[model samples]
Target: MSYVLAKSQNDDIHNAGECGGAVTSIFKYLLDEGLVDGVLAIKPGDDIYDGVPTFITDSDDLIGAAGSYHCAPTMVGNIIQKYLYDKKVAVTVKPCDMRSIDELIKRYKIKKENIYTIGLNCGGTVSPITGRKMIELYYDVDPDDVESEEIDKGQFIIELKDGTEKGVKIHDLEMEGYGRRNNCQRCDVKIPRNANIACGNWGSQDGWTFIEINDEKGQELIDGAKNAGILETKSPADPAVEGRLKVEGIMKKMASKVQSVKYPLVSEMDEWNRCIGCYACRDICPICWCCENCELNKDYFTLEENSSPDPLAFQGVRLSHMSFSCVDCGQCDDVCPMDIPVSLIFDKLQKKYYERTGYVAGVSDDVKPPLYSPEKTEL
Candidate 1:
């Protein structure tokens, strides 16, 4: 409901963090005050490209978790639902991550009161495998030598360990099948308003982060940090606020252009014939939590015919069951052993469902999808 331009007061935090270290400083305040048991965030793994989601219980370790990881696309919501449901935690989430969390909260799978959500505005994310290949093929650099990566002003930029930097137009990289994930390229939810607070560098200058406090918890977070003397805050000027809006609009427009072209279905793609039936797609999905009693496992729908199961029998059944709730996070495609565009069909169905019900999968105000809510049925 309100916006602030903020930066960390700690010199180490400001130097270690992206934008302004506001996010890291806020997490430090939460941990120091015992507000949460831990902060779940992504940190560098083997390298900058390998983003590992870490649960930091100590404020001293929070600085290591700072900065952005565009090539490290990990699903935070599914991890919480499976592992940290009983714990009180604060988490940083992308739009897709928040969407999944929103749906889980609605389903009573995640307790809304137990978690604080810090949403990050994402232009898009790149696959580590694809990113490495793209960097070598286009940027002409060794992917391992790269120290950091960022997407800004339509360019995918990278900094080397020697302090050299390189950039390429994302459109050019994507045009040759090498940029962001397909789902990310078409994602319309650039900012997660459903999160308690959304933070990013979109509208701010070199040393500040633009924060949008969506709820009481978010306001409390800013107030607490500012009062603790770890953070400084002020209202963003008119041009800063408008610039943020303009950037958001441009990102949404790019997504609209991607969506204007129709996405293909699983039935239309022949890649499904290569399915090895490992079921990784189902396992990776944040929304498909019915692993114990999935209908796809029933004898009637069993895939007993080698690796080539009938698409209609395999994906078709899941479509009827959960496609309406697909957040378009693209985990299905990422985990598919057959290289099938599994999320595409699910996203297409969700969009089709949207066309009829005006209910967006993860961002809707509705308590449940129309299919699950009899009173809200469109027909």
Candidate 2:
């Protein structure tokens, strides 16, 4: 067995695209500590999977590990599912990723001993669909042409191999769906609960990071780094981190917004009028469409095969019914070509479900999700 720790330092937070250095550092630390036999993470490459899942046993392989803020890293989830069949694997994920893992653990789809998680504190994530399209439309660049990338101060910087560069400022891309992810807009779990160690931009004064070890495993990794002299722990903030306060302020504002608005759910059945019955939302969801025996896929909603008296009629029902299965990760809304707010249904359901059942779907694996446990039935 070996050690696993998730660490990243990327401005984009899309998929660990920018933090190749930080990811390599952690993998090296784990190798030294002998806590992991292998690490599962995304690495940059020229293959079709430019940002594809990688299993690194040799420390040298980790050099290719990178970071991004892309929201739909479904490959990470698929990798976790696949590897759980064998040895323990350490993985790096953002807050949203952590939540999905928590949900999986509850379903007994993954075992704790077989997995070690490192969570990155997330401010938000970008839709990769939008990212790829923006590059193609604005810069005439393909997703593979860029060697590396980052998003900061409202600018999308793509470093190309031809010594050519492409940059789109946030203002220019504001109407371009740059900051659109259903879960991000309503996310309350800024700090991930499934991680053994959490790292990110939360406590730093400058662009540098302030890593926080949350568990014994995390502590071991950090301590090993200190012993190896790969990293140095500094004193607490002097006047406190400047952006820390700003982040707190913005979260409060978002919380208020969540409270002020009503979420749409399939249970309501009235919110899906805009839906053309295209099933686009279902196809794009990261979680709900996991099964091949999908009832919706068989056109079970229609009176006849491939027939619907009214296509949009089932949209609201579909969303409300699927709310319970939703982690509020927002793939449904992000994928809607019609710009329908499918996530709003999950958001309201999450709030209502949390209030009624006092449960959060993907917080931790320490206990079963409250909805699934009848040992302490409130009813």
Candidate 3:
């Protein structure tokens, strides 16, 4: 592993990117150098809050994807698995997205060699609708006037178009149900170490990005970008490194408190009674790719007259099949029409599985989960 403070040499990129243009420059280098066919990243749609994933094949178009949107919450793993499996692509990933890719790679659903992951350090993401309302209710400012948003030091900050900023305590917002998604609040994986490179502003001075190169591929990406004269780098100072670690520790501690409060035993969740057998949760699950021959579709598992399914048969089936690999990305929770906390049970089970087996899913390359292995030995 290696650490460095880097920034874009290009004036436009340096200004357009969130902290620095390190990630965008790397993608540009990959595209210009013909290392990848395309880049998968988010670009603003109708507004800055409306972030939509875009696939760019041209180096010039990479500028549109610069900067970050905390409201996007789009998942690129399924997109890659479904569409870009055969093509070489560079993509930015949040921790959950990286975890989904790792799980998919292990399942042979995605080709590892064809994809390069540039992981972002994520605090969390707020849903678009909720975020807009949050601005109106809490910040007392028009959400449309906001040009940029950030989560830093326990505050949700927004920069308005008139050169003014507003800040709100994240804890206060969450107390009123206005902060990040429930799964995101409980997420402790702030850094995607499994990616080729992890980049963020945590350990850097202003106008720079702090990067951790996890492998040879990441080192090559950095070196190539610098060689192309689009990026510059320097070693980070000791205090900056310590500050980053301290911030990470605080975030994880917050996550642990949230987990205890949000994730109760599956037995206690009464929202399952509202399920309509729509199968939306399964459809949105990143790991649930069995389309034609899902066990839940079988006669034994499906009651012909009943629209509400047995929780054990439906959610339980999913937990057994993929819970060990669940990254708790919250797609299940997002798509559930009944508003069930679908990820809660799966996340709890995965954590329990980790406790029993000493396995943390999607974080390691050398070990596979015991359920996926042929050996019957207990941990």
Score residue 337 of candidate 1 by CA lDDT: 66
Candidate 1 lDDT score at position 308: 34
| Per-model TM values vs. the true structure | 0.95, 0.71, 0.96
Clashes of each: 0, 24, 0
Candidate 2 lDDT over 1-379, as tens digits, reads: 1122223332232233243234446666676567777888776444322456678877656655655534335435545664544666778877767777766666666676776677776655656666667778888877767655654433557778786777877446645555435456567776664587766555453434445566787776666765775544554363344454465466546645654653423443445555677776765554543546656556656777667525555565565555555666666765677666677666676667767766666763437656556675763
Query: What is candidate 2's CA lDDT for residue 96?
Result: 69
lDDT of 1: 0.87
Candidate 1 has a TM-score of: 0.95
The best candidate by TM-score is: 3
lDDT tens digits, residue span 208-233, model 3: 99999999999999999999999999
Alpha-carbon shift of residue 339 in model 2 (angstroms): 5.9
Candidate 2's C-alpha runs over 4 A off are 1-20, 32-34, 45-50, 67-75, 132-176, 205-207, 238-245, 248-325, 334-340, 364-366, 375-379
Q: Say which prediction, candidate 2 or candidate 3, comes out ahead on TM-score.
A: 3
TM-score of 2: 0.71
